[model samples]
Structure formats: structure tokens, C-alpha cells
Target: MWTINDFPAYGSLSGWSTKGYLACPNCNIDASSQSLRSKIGYMGARRYLPENHNWHRSKLFNGEIENRSKPVELSGEQILQQINLGTIDGKNKDTDKARLDLEDMQIRKELHLIRHANGSFQKPPALYTLSPAEQIGFYDFLQSVKYPDGYAANVSNCVTAKGGKLVGLKSHDCHLCSKTLRVTDLEKLQEQIILILCKLEKIFPPAFFDVMVHLAIHLPYEARLGGPVQYRWMYPIERMLSLLKGFVGNKARPEGSIAEAYISKECTSMNQLQNENSPKATDEMWSLANGPNALTNTCLGCICNGVQFHTIDRDNRRKCQNSGLVVKGDHEDQLIKFYGYLCKVWELTYLFGHRVVLFQCEWYNTGSSRTLRVEPHVTTVDIRSRWYKDDSFVFPSQVQHVFNVPDTKLRPNWRVVEKFQHRRIWDVPELDMPEFDEVLQDDENSTIVPTEPIDDVVVLRRDDIVPQIISMEVSQSNKRVQPEGVMDDAFICDDDDELTISGDDEEDEMENDFDTDTDLEF
Candidate 1:
């Protein structure tokens, strides 16, 4: 049960004895220290380093280099220095922090749930209720149980020192098939890991689920765990989910046609998961805990949105910089854009948790269900006995390339036009509907209320074209004014190289006079 807290610095597991040093397993020349990199579960080698330590070793073993000992060891300071040199991994540290923030929010929500298990209160629980050290201890215990390899939650090969001097390095024998994995076999292991994690992400929340599945995969056979059975069930489920969108949209199919195709695909992929590769205890547990539709139900809304409008293929390296759209900006088109972005976050969030909801409204049909989803209206989702507050999502930016809302000029859909019309009529009051304040319970949650009511009132005039401001300089480095069209002499471009000789004599005299004036002043 090693936790991140146990090691003040990044160190090896405590229960394990580092009593003996092993020979450089690859080199058989220099002695390998019993530190983090040389031991089992030390897969963070490529994280901050420019080259994989193993890559260097592989090259050496392949005779790319004669001496392996010449490989440089990156100091802690060097790693930080490299990070400052503009590695995106350094920014990933912030994303991890964001994840931790989300986790903290989840924990707070969980504590609230625990406190209100028998009550109706939705207030945040007090921090003093749980011991700080004890909470830390619980997190550590979870880390050890769920993620024994590292904080990254990556599956790793377990190795033991053969000779007292650390000569031999071999993997622990696979329980399913008494075969040992070398470093060469690690890629296969990583693929299996991706499949398992991706499957679990669809079923369970990423933060908790990844850790749980990792633990289940690694748990030994003698523990009498059902990890294998778990994985077996999920294999089909994952296959079904992967192909769900395709089946639904097939024109040659009926509604149930997709289901059969999904089932057939499931069996095929399942057989491959079990037969092609050996399933680990962690893989099994992950598969079992996440049942079919556990993923399907929670992710149904997100998948529906993704399948409907967004493209799964896009250049993901770019981030959307449309700060104009951040505060749910102007333009109905902007609202649609926001819809896509919100849904993308929801999909990502769903991969992270089960408590996701895609909010929608029946007000003024937009043909697209998500238009209803974006309305500041509530879409009640029943999570067992209790109702959880959920909102609709805008699709992710990566998917925006294809997921553009149908253009209104094509007379899009009457329903969409009607929704926009109703959205614009700001003053009209409706009695049967719940006010944003009442439904959101702004008094308790303190959620920000939009200045204008979203339902009957229109926010902007449809016929009025939004003026795109074009600024022009009033004078050199002074205030600017909006220019309607191209300036007559906007930029002066002279064909002939007319060198100005005006005031040359006076300029020379001025320069001499300035020099003389400076000398006199001195």
C-alpha cells in the first residue's frame, strides 16, 4: 500500500527491500542502483527526460552505442530547467491541478451527499467534519490500492533482482499464461491498457474509475477477485459503444438493426480481448464493475450529441481562442457554438464521472434537442431515488469543424426559427413555466441569473445586422474612429524612390546647433 505521501521525495515502495543492487540488466556491465528507474513500476522515465532511458539502452543493445554508462542522468533541477524550456508537459501539470480541483469539488459534493443522506439540505459540508490527516490517509490508501504503479496510473512490468549483485532482471510470470514479459512486450501491454481505460472511461468516471480499474487489473489471483469476469463483460460493451453511432445512422437499417450489429461487433471484439492477449486482474475488475449501459445510459446524451453534429476527426493541437464566446456571447450562432463547447466538456466530464447530465428544454422547438439543452431551463434527470442538477453541453472545439449548426439561410428548420423567435421576445411572461431562479434555486446555490429571461423574450433583433467595428486612426498614435470603407490613401506606396531633400541645409544646421548648444550647456 504505497502512497504518494509516504515518499517525501519520489522513492521506491517501502515494503520491498532495495537491499541488493542489480547489474545493468541490459548492459551487464555497470551496476544498476535500486532507485526508481531501475525497479519494477518505474515507468515515469520518459515523462521529463528528452530521451527514454530505455531508448538509450535499446540503442546500446542494438549496437547503436558502445558504452551505455555515458547516458546522462537528468537531475531534479535539470528536469525543472527542461520544463521551463517550454515542454507542454509542464502545462499538463496545470491540467493535473485542474483535475485535482475538480476532484476536490467532487469530494465536497460527496461530503454534502453523505451529510444529507437522510436530510434535504444541499449546502456544502464543513471541512472540520473530517480529520485532515485521516482524509489524506484515506487518499493514500486509495492510491496504494488503486494505483500501485505510479500517480500516472500506468500499468508496468514487475521485476525482481536475480543475483545479490543485481545481475538478472525478469518479469513476474503472468498468472493466466505462465509467460514472462520483457521490455519489448511493454507496447502490447500499453495497448491493452488503453483499451481497458477507454472502456472504463465510458462506463465510470475517469478520476475514480481509472484508479479502481488499475487496482483490479493488478490484484493477484489468490485474492479471489472477480477481475476477469468484470473485464469479460465490458469487452462486448466497449465494442458496442465504439460502433453505436455508425449503427444508428445506417440508412439500410431499422432501429433494432443497429442493436444486432452492435451485438455481433461485441462478440468479435470480446473474443479478441480474451484470446489475443492475457487479461490481468486489473483489467478484469475494470470490466466487471462497469456493466453494459452503465456507460451507455450515462453517456447516451453525450454520444447522441457527438454522433449528431460533431466530427470525431480534427486537428486537436489547437485551443479555441474565441474569448468573444466565453460569457455565452452575442449572436445566435455564438450560442450554437457555445452549445458545442459545453457538450464537449460534458463528454469529457462524463468520461471522468457518472453524475453527468445533458440539460434540454421543450421551449420553442429548435428541431435539435440540444438547443433546448442550452436554454437556462432545467431538464430533470433521475439518478436513482434522487434528482441531480444537470445542464446541457456545447460540443467540443475539436469537433466544431463539422458540427456547425445548420445555416438559417437554407430555411433550416421551422422549429429552429421558431425557437430563435421566441428566444428574442424578451418581455412576454409565461405562467406555467418555472422561472430560472425557482428551478435553479439561486438563493441556495447562488447561481448567476441572466439579466434577461431566456424563455419568451428575444435577446437580439434578428433583422438587425450586427455592426462589425473597424477602427481607423484619428491622428498618429492618438484616438481611433470607426471607418466605414477603405481609406482613399490608407497606405501610401510610391513607385518612384523620391528621396526628400527639403530642409537639408536647415537640418544640418540644426544638428550642428544642437551639438554646439549641448557643449555650451555642459
Candidate 2:
């Protein structure tokens, strides 16, 4: 039968529009109202994760979070509410206002610091500088992919020729000849590159391992266990969990904008490498921690009782010899012991996978708990009234299609909102001609000019491919097998095709704020 592809003319029975259904005015995918509405369950809803930035960040739920706190169970209605109005906390308008205020204050503070540090030393540049082309090339040489040799020496020599001599270094010195650079130059280069790299890595990260773990847990035993349903909410849920974890100090963003850029760039390579080099743990271990046993192998279990086991020795008991087998502990004690056993299993699974499960353990333990303060207005709401009433309520009937959307089924699109074309990339404000001319007039172009050879050398290079000016094309599939620039000394791929599932990578992205040792001068 030919089915109507358009949204059902009928009103939505569920709280929000489900996949395969056209977006309703009240749903996350409501395109017409997108600018006016806040997305509730969309994956890309978190571009404003940095509390300092103005992007409307929200406190979305990871199923696990709700699982831990009974009062915070997410229901369809709550999710829909978030979608319609952003977060209950000031919504999009409030976030935008906050962002503007923060940015203004930050800019003022930075200006104040700059004035304090170098107010006297700042020199008004002489009129008549290099052309615009020269300025662009110079900036590129210093900060772009192409690295220039003898750049500093050339710059210093040029400066000395124009004026009598630079007070610091003699011309004959290699450092003056551009053989070496000042600490400031090195620091600047590092900063630029790190920013670029982090931006890249953020595109992908460890939360992606959830699907892999789910597969590893059930794949070998039940081939059909990890099909559509398991993955329906997997990607969005994982991303939501990552943000939640971050709020709780389990994940972090260090080096600010620069680190974020680097992560986005390298995340794909990292994921592939980690997956290939993944380790293995015994099945007993896998079933303990994050698996079904997470129910019994939790902190509550440890504080209360462990696990339960069963045994029989009725024949030996009849003879009063207990020869055939010996049983120890009562039912309650056995249950607690069983719980402990489950925890170990989970620990083992975590060890085998390329992940780390943060748990409280006496030996080899490293985990901390801290208060996670959400926005004052961000209050918990129910996805469904029943979900709050009975945290364990399973609403399979509320099961909606989540994973099969176009671009969504793939790895790269897991955390992206494929529906919209991003405006930020193209919406940079145009440069005012008068302001540009004035800045260019007094700029010292010679110092920034790029005399370096323009080539693809700055990017990754393959062993087999020769660099050519016209084109630099490499097969995408082959590139995945061995990414360029990865050193021969790098960690080798494990022999096993399948690795035991651990949860470290997934958790790392959730740290509240990561510590960075970025050393950049400007």
C-alpha cells in the first residue's frame, strides 16, 4: 500500500513528534519554529556547551543520570518541553543575552591587561607599509600550514637594514639570520596549531564507543541483540550523557577554543586508532559493570548486599559428612557476595575495553564526586508523568524510531544535526573598508610577509605519494587503513579484530573541565 509520506494530518499521540513523522510545531525537528524554539532531544543542541559562550546550552538528560537519581527520570512530556522552550532555565533568549554580556566583559578585561602590560612600549607604526598581498602572505607564513625557513632572520635583517640595527642580536648570529626564533614566535606557532587540532578532534570522541561496547557485549552471544532498537537512541543519548558527565566534572574542555578545534580535527583518527587497538576482557567481566548487572553491581549493591549464587549438596548432608560439596553463608550473605562478584565482572570488562569506568574502589581507584550546579532556572521535568512516578517503568510502547535517519546512521553524523546548514561558517561580518585601510596603512608588513614556498608540505604526507603542486589526492579508504603523519613508532594495532568493551574514552569527554598545558605567548 502506498503510504502518505507527509506528516500525518492527525494530531500527535506522543508528547513530541517521532521519527518518520513530520515535525510538529511543538517538536525538536520543527524547522519553521527552529529559530524561535529550543530543541529538546536533538544531538546538535549542545554547540553552546561552554557555559561562557552564548550558545543556548541546556541540561539534557542521559538515561543513566535519570537511572541514578529517581526524582530526575526523563519522560516524553519533559523532553518535549525542553524542545519547545529551550531549557526551563532562561531558554535561548536568556542564554544569548548572557553570552553577549560575558563576551563584552571578557574583551574589556583583556584590553585592560594589554594596556597594563605594554602601554608604554607600543609603537605607532610609520606610514607607507607593504601591500595587502604581502600582509596576507606574511600572516600565512607565520600562522598557516606552510612553515617558512629563515623567516625570522629575514625579518630581523630587513628590519636592521631599514633602521640602523636591532639592539638585541647581531646579523651574523644564526638566531638573527632566522636559523632560530624567539620563545614568543615558537609559542605563537604552537598555540595556533593546537587550536586547529582541538577544533578537529571535537568532531568525534570516545562517547562513540557506546555502540561498540553494546555490540561487543551482545554480538558474540546474540547476533541480533544489537540491531535497530539498541541503537535507536544510542547516538543522541551518548552525546547527552557526555554533556551531563561534563557538568558533573567527569569530562572537560581545556585550552578553551583552541583545544576544542584540535579535538574536532583529530577525533576521527583517534576513534579509528582506539577501536583498532582496543583490548579484550573475559565475558564474566563484561557482564558485571555496564552490562545488565550494572543494576546489581552498583555502589548501592556494595553498600547494601553483593550478588547471589546457588549450590546443592543434599546427598552429602544426609550422611552428615558434607563430602560432596561445601556451601557457606546464608541467602542474604550470598546475595551481597554475588553483588561483589558482579562489580568485579564490570571492572574486568572496563579493563578490557578502551574505556574506563569511574567507580569507587579501594585499590587502583581514581574517582571523585562533586556538586553539579545547573542553571538556577534549569529544573527537572518529567518526560512522562509516569516516568517520574515509577523510575523503572519501561515504556517500550513509547518506543520511537531514533537511529535510521539519513546522515544519522553513519558514525560522523552521530552528534551532528544534519538537517540544517550551519550559518556560523559563512556569516562572518564583512570587513569595513575604512577600518581595513587604516589598519593596513601603519602595519609592519615586512615582519609578517610570507617569503616561504607555497606547498602542501605542512599537512599530512603519505609515504607512497609524491607531492605535486597541481593536485594532492589520496584514496579515502586507504587513508583510513593508515593515516598519514602517524609515526611508525606509534602504538601498533592489536591482533584481535574485536576488543573487550571498557568505558574510559566515553567518560573522558564528560570531564567538567580538562586541564591543558598549552604554552602560547599570544
lDDT by residue (tens digit), candidate 1, 282-378: 6545544663233332221222221221112111211111111111322445553222222222221222122233322112222244433333433
Candidate 2 minimal-lDDT segment of 10 residues: 336-345
Q: How would you encode candidate 2's per-residue C-alpha lDDT over 1-522 as one tens digit per residue?
A: 001121222223333332221132232232111111111111222221333432222122111111111112346686777667642110111122222221222321211111123222211111112334444444333221111111122222222222121222222222211211233333343334323322322221212221111112121222122221212223345655655444442234533644555566579768766764633455436534544423332221111111111111221112111011111212334421100001111111233333222222111100111111122322111111111111221111211111011122233212111111111211223464524223212222123222232221122212232221212221122111211222234223211222112111111111122322211100
lDDT of 2: 0.23
TM-scores, all candidates, are 0.17, 0.13
| Candidate 1 TM-score to native | 0.17
Clashes of each: 36, 57
**Who wins the lDDT comparison?**
1
- Whole-structure CA lDDT of model 1: 0.25
RMSD of each: 35.1, 32.5
For model 2, the superposed segments whose C-alpha errors exceed 4 Å read 1-115, 119-335, 338-522
Candidate 1 Cα errors over 4 Å, as ranges: 1-20, 23-28, 34-299, 302-522
